[model samples]
Target: MAKLKEKKALMIIAERNFRDEELLEPKKILEDREIKVTIASTSLQNSRGMLGATVKPDLLLSSVKVQDYDVIIFVGGGGASQYWNDPLAHSIAQKAVQKDKILGAICIAPVTLANAGVLSGKKATVFSSEISKLEAKGAIYTGKPVQVEGKIITGEGPQSAEQFGEAIVKVLENLPE
Candidate 1:
C-alpha cells in the first residue's frame, strides 16, 4: 500500500473580466472532491468577473511553479486575451504539456493555450469567436461543448464550464500518482 498523492489544480484568470462560471464552477467541483484548487492572476489584486463576480487570486501568475499542480486551467473572458500574447503565460502552458499535466481552458481562454503552441496538433474547442485562433495554431477545432485530447482539455464557453471541470477531474483521477 502507498499513500496516493493529493491532487492540486491551478486556475489562471485575468486580472479583470474573467468569466465567473468558468472559474467558480470548476473550482467548486474540484474542491468538492477534496482536491486543492489555487487561483492565480496577472496581478495579486482582486479580479472582477464579466458578470460582476469578484475573486481574490492567491498568487501572481508570474510566480507560479507549474509543477505544484496536477492540473492547470485558464479561465476565459474577454480579458483573457491578455494572456493570448503573453510569453510568461505561454511558457507556463508549454511547461504544463512538457510535464504531462492535465491542462484545461474554457471559453476564449483556449486561445491562450493555442497561442502557446501547446494545442498544436491536438483536438480542442473554444468559444466560437476564437475557433479560428485555435485552428491557426494547428489545433483541430472540435465544435463540441467540451473536447479532450490527451491531457489537454478545452471547453467551448461558459455553457460548458461544469462539464469542462468534470472532464479535467476524469483525466486527473485516471492518471498515475
Candidate 2:
C-alpha cells in the first residue's frame, strides 16, 4: 500500500482520571500508521489514568497551538467529566473545529466537545451514560460505537476504543493534506 498522503496529529487530551485504554489504544493505532501522536493535558508533570496508571504528556495545552495539527482527539474518562467545562479544554475543541481540523472525542470527552459548541446540531455518538448531557447541549445522539459526521468523530466508550481509532485512521486517510 502506498503511504497515506495525509499526515495526522493525534492529540490525546486527558485529565487526572483519563481511562488508560481510551487513550492508549487509539494512540497505538494512529502511531502504527506512522501518524504523529501527541499526548497533551492540562498540566505537564504527570496525569493519573482512571485505573491509577500514570501517564506523561508530550505538550501542555497552554503551550501548544491547535492549528499545527490536522487532527485533535479528546480522550475521555471520569477525569474528563470533571474537566469538560474547563476553559482550556473548551478552547482547544472550539479552535480545532473552527479551523476545520479533524476533531474527535471518545467516551465522556464528548462532553468537552459539547461544551466547546462543536456538537450542536451535529450527529454524534458518545458514552451512553452521558447521552442526555450531549443531547441537552443540542447534539443528535447516536447509540453506537463510532460515528463520524463531517470533521467531527465520536466513540461510545472504552469498549469501542479500537473501533474509534480505526475510524479516525480511515478519516485521516481520506482527507487530503
Every candidate's CA RMSD: 1.8, 1.9
Residues 1-177, candidate 2: write the lDDT tens digits: 324434657566565888888888988898888887888886787899888778889888787688888889989888887557788778888899889988999998898899788899999998878998899999999898999998899999999999999998888777754
lDDT of 1 by residue, 89-151 (tens): 999999999998889999999999989999888899999988889999999998999998989
Lowest summed lDDT across 10 adjacent residues in model 1 is found at: 1-10
- In Å, residue 148's CA in model 2 sits off its true spot by 0.5
Error of 2 at 176 (Å): 2.6
Q: What would the TM-score be for candidate 1 when compared with the true structure? A: 0.96
What TM-score does candidate 2 reach? Answer: 0.92
Best-matching candidate per TM-score: 1
Error of 1 at 50 (Å): 0.6
Give all TM-scores, in the order shown.
0.96, 0.92
**lDDT scores for all predictions?**
0.91, 0.84
